[model samples]
Target chain A: MDKKIAMVDDDTDLLNIYKPVLEKAGYIIKTAFDSSEGLKLYKEFKPDVIFVDLSMEHFDSGFVLCHRIKSLPEAKKSKVIIMTSAGHETGIRFSTDTEEEKNWIKADDYLEKPISPRDLVQYLNEKIFKEK
Target chain B: MKIENGKILVVDDEKGMREGIRRILEIQGHKVDTTDSGALGIQKGIATEYDIYFIDLKMPDIEGTQVLREIKLMYPEAICVIVTAYASIDTAVETTRMGAYQYIPKPFEPDELQILVHRALERRWYILEARRLREEQAKHLLEVAHEQSRMRTIINALDDGILIINQEGQAVLFNPGFLKLLDINQEISIGEPVLEILPTALRDQIKEIFSGKGSVNAIKQEITIHPPAKLVVMANTTPVMGKKGELLGVVSVLRDISELKKIDIIRSQFVDMAAHELKSPLTAVQGYLELVVDKTLGDEPDLYDSYLKRSLDRTKSLVNLINDLLNITRLEAGKVRRELNRQNIKELIIDRLNFFKNDISERALKVNVDIDSNLCVDADRDDLLRLFTQIIANAVRYNKPNGQVNITGRQNTHYVKIDFQDTGLGIKKEEQDRLFEDFFRAKNEFTRNITGTGLGLTIAKKIVDAYAGKIKVESEYQKGSTFSVYLPFAKQNNFTIKNSP
Candidate 1:
């Protein structure tokens, strides 16, 4: 069975650009435009990996979505990643490397924007297939 | 010391006696005026105010004692000597009791008259010296009083609060500004303890100074007073030192910095928002370019065409964002050099609408304009163009397919009112108040596909404000929005167009 993935962002172009590239790598992908839509998609698709943009309808939309997803019984098997351009935008870097940060952010990992397709695939493989 | 050149008046009925005294006194460098009649002597004595007066015991016109009494009444400090051949102890004692300095018996030698004149002049010098010292002291006291009052006036007129406390922590002096800044409405007595009246933070700072725990140099602290109103103040307390290097008191100057603090917070927030707005587009552009460069999708060039096109679109929007940022910066910094002209509002709207011809056609949006041909506003050409472009751009950009945009202009006695009504996705009621704030954009399902820097309305509002105009909006969710701009009519406005050199 193929590993399933979900991407949520307000930028339609970004989703379009990344979807084909990720699909070419043999992973099934689904996309949503906002937090609520992303949450609804997560429930229906139950994807193995989720990529959420930090700023969508709101700046902290990803954080709220991540917390909602982590609260669900099905979320334990899924890995959630929060993507942000905040490091470039505000000069403030965020990380979920520590247990406290991971718990508070309710995210499995974090990535900065302008992320290349190859790097994103590699990060996903390391977090998903390598651990298994 | 003897004062030799005394001004002397001799009032004697005896010609020989008067002449003899004048000759002796004149030789001693004294200015002598001898009057034969006692009445004329009194007149001369009072007019000249001679330092010393010599009167005979008897006179025909007025008694010599009468002259003495009259001179003493007018010039109380005057030195008077009685010279009479009928001098006896009773008469001598009587004249001496009536402000007479001394008595010289008549039929005396020239030496006796010289000795009497010398002693009387010495006494006259002492009286004049004492009077001069008293006058000098009074004038000095008056100048000191004036200086103190001037200092008080200056302190009271200052906008910054001032408080001077004694070493005992008592409020020795305070100004009206002090009371207002501290929000103290009660009558503060001169010797009131300052710690009780001051806010806790400032009171603690003063206590630290009095306790000698901190450096004695001026301690500057930012403190907030919260009660009736929130006030931020910069309190600079320095020890007032005396000549002996003793701490006399402390002088605290409290300046209200609340406005500056608020501006500082706003400026930082604006910077953060602007940075975030800029970065979002850059991220997309960079990602698209990177995907093209890496050929992430495949080896086919056609696959990258759409990505490149999107990148180009993002770059164009980035450029627009930068331009908007610069325009806002210039507008807010008051650096826009205005070229004022009487511009017809209807004509301007028509011209601006032409810029959106392609968008209007592409979206199938109908634009109907019914504006008065002669309605005009006195404003900078570029400012009005930018203002119109922003509002019109929003009407077209946010409108649904086959939407209708209605623009109308009318004039009143003072203002020219122009309205741009668009069948567009209107703002939520809760978000309406923040519509004109910097980088504040409505984030909802309707606005999801809209690409904007969110600075258009902010810049529009700023430009309108610069022209002393007002811009407001009336809208209902999912229906449409009407943006009304009220600018003063060119002819009715009091704006003076400064001629450029």
Candidate 2:
């Protein structure tokens, strides 16, 4: 079966650009424009991997949504990735490398924005598929 | 030792006794005058303020006691010694009690007369010296009092709050600023304990200082006080030391840094928002361009056409955002060079409407204009054009199909009012207040697809403000929004059109 992925971002243009590229890599991708819709989409689709933007209607909406997803009993095996534009813009680094950071951020991994689709697929394969 | 010479007067009924006393006193470097009659002696004594007077107990015209009384009344500090032939203890004691320096015997030796003259001169010197010292002390006291009041006036005039507390933590001195900063309405008298009155954070810091646990160096802290109103102050408390290098008290200077703190918060928020806004377009442009460059969708040139078109649109918006940012910075920094001109409001509005003609027709927006022909304002032509362009573009862009955009201008005595009314999706009631803030956009289901830098109204408001004008908005959530701008009328017949070079 093809890998199911969920992506959430406020910018519709970015979602449109990335959706076709990711689907071409043989992944079934679902997208939402905001955190509430993203959460609702997560429950119904139960995608194997989730990508969340660090900011949406509110600055910390992605963190809140990720925490909600991690707290759900059904989200145990699903890997969550938080996409951050803030690291480049604000000079603040967000990472889930340490166990403490993973527990606090409730994210399996993080990626800086302006990420290329080629690198994104490679990162996913290395971290998610190879680990299994 | 240099002898301080004395002037002496001797009054005696016997001529031999008077001459004899004069001879003896004159040899002691004293100038002595003698008279046989008591009335002559009184006249001579009164004329010259002699340091000592030698008056016989039994005189002819005026009695010795009478001469003594008259001289003492004229010069209270005068030293008068009585010389009597009888030498009775009664007469000697009576003359002494009546302001006489001392009494001399009639059969006295030359040494006795000389010694008496020297002692009386010494006594006179001491009285004058004491009087001089008293005058100097009174003058010194007045100067000290004047200096203290001058210091008090200086402290009261300062804008920063100043508080001086004693080692016991009681307020010894405070200025009016202190009361204003701390929001203390009631009068605080000297020696009032101020530990309870201070905010908890500051009180704890002060307590640590008093306990000798805190650093002896000045403790600089930012403290917040809230109750009647929120206030933030930078409290710089230092230990006031004595001459012996011991702590006398603490002096805290509280500067109202609330304004600075507010500006700091706003600056950071603006930076964060600018970063986010700037990154979004770049991300989209990069993603679209990468797909075209890599030819991710299998070797067809036609497949990349749509991506390139979208990338162009994103790049255009990025340029627009940068221009808006620069305009705002220039406006805020007062660096915009403006050329004054008398601009007809009606003509300017029509020109701006022409610029938006394409967008208006594309959306099928109906444009209406009602303005007075002679209505004019004193403004830079380019600034006025930009201001009208922003509002007119918003009316067309935000309007629905077949929507109406009505532009009206009216002139009163001092101002010409221009109103832009659009039949479009208006702002929410809660979001209306934030409409003029930098980078604020009305993001909703309807406005989600609207392409704007979100700085149109902000720039429009700034341009209007530069002309000492006002901008107001009235909106209903689903109905529409009307933005009214009021500009002061240009002076009549003094119109000078100057263009920027």
Best by DockQ: 1
| Candidate 1 residue lDDT tens string, B37-76 | 9889888888878888999978888989999999999998
What does the lDDT read for residue B156 in candidate 1?
95
Q: Model 2 clash pairs?
A: none
**Candidate 2 lDDT tens digits, B249-349:** 88889999989988776677667777777887899889888888898877867768888888898889999888888888888888778999889989998
Candidate 1's displacement at residue B235, Å, is 3.3
- Which candidate tops TM-score? 1
After TM-score superposition, the amount by which residue A79's alpha carbon in candidate 1 deviates from its true location, in angstroms, is 4.4
**What's the true lDDT of residue B450 in model 2?**
76
TM-score of each: 0.81, 0.66
The TM-score obtained for chain B by all candidates, in the order given, is 0.80, 0.63
What stretches of model 1 exceed 4 Å from their correct place?
A58-64, A70-73, A86-119, A127-130, B1-50, B53-57, B82-85, B104-122, B149-217, B224-231, B239-251, B334-340, B492-501
The per-model DockQ list reads 0.37, 0.32
Count of backbone clashes, every candidate in sequence: 0, 0
Pairs with backbone N, CA or C atoms under 3 Å apart (clashes), candidate 1: none
Q: State each model's CA lDDT, in order.
A: 0.86, 0.83
lDDT of 2 by residue, A1-132 (tens): 789999998778888888988898888999988888989999999999999988765456788889899989999879888997763333223334457656767787778888887788887778777757
